[model samples]
Target: MSNVIFTSSATAKNGRDGHVKSDDGLIDLKLVNPANNQVAKGSNPEQLFAAAYSACFDGALNLVASQQHKKIDSETNAEVSFCKDPEDDGFKIAVTLNIEIQGVNPEDAQQLAEDAHQACPYSKATRGNIDVKLNPKAV
Candidate 1:
């Protein structure tokens, strides 16, 4: 385990139909309202999670590449789907990640993509809890 570095705090009001704001007020936004199992207004949790995970994964990839003394400009995209599960009688999430790392061989890029998933905090946190598919589209 690593030493504690920093912690973040954010608050959400009125559940999924009101507002959410970070403690620093940098991420203040209205929550989305779901009608007929679809978003009717504003942003939703899945969107937020997707954005965070994609950016975090890219950062982790860059970090790992740099640690290997290599430079890469890459894009990692995360597609998150939130759906209701009949068996669990609750909501569940599925994620698909496509990572493209530049300036590397395809095999090396795939290796980096796999390594990045292991190093990414979001990936680590969500492991075994959700369905996640990682596809490296490196060229």
Candidate 2:
């Protein structure tokens, strides 16, 4: 078998009490409870998923655009929602991606978005289990 590895470490601060450490024990990360706060701080599963999905989608879009020789300058936003499954008490996620790319035709932008959605790692991982919506706009 082949092996690939990375490391993450976390410490409790004002947000969450406990921290998580990776195998190699390098990078630090934490999970915080956003109970009274409006936004989630520290690190949580949803935040991690959101970060992963957003970055993956953006990378996928960039790959598609580069392959098609298109120039796009804008932002991509991904919102990932996680909730407990009522039946099994498991977690489920829902993602909504909004992409704004300037100087590209709407059709081409849409095509790139389609390709990105197909290529995104998080989308591929959560296929058929969660709801993922992609909205691409040309600005």
* Worst lDDT 10-window in candidate 1: 32-41
Per-residue alpha-carbon lDDT of model 2 for 23-80, expressed as tens digits?
5566467667554355655666567667767887898888888888988875788887
TM-score of 2: 0.73
Q: Positional deviation of 31 in candidate 1, in angstroms? A: 0.8
lDDT of 2 at 116: 83
lDDT of 1 by residue, 23-126 (tens): 99989988875543363668878888999999999999999999998888999889999778887799888999988888998888988998899999999999
C-alpha lDDT of residue 69 in model 1: 87
Top model number, TM-score:
1
Q: In model 2, which residue pairs have backbone atoms overlapping below 3 Å?
A: 9-27, 9-28, 9-29, 10-29
Q: Give all candidates' CA lDDT scores.
A: 0.88, 0.75
Q: After TM-score superposition, what is the CA distance of residue 100 in candidate 1 from its true location, in Å?
A: 1.7
The whole-model C-alpha lDDT of candidate 2 against the native structure comes to 0.75
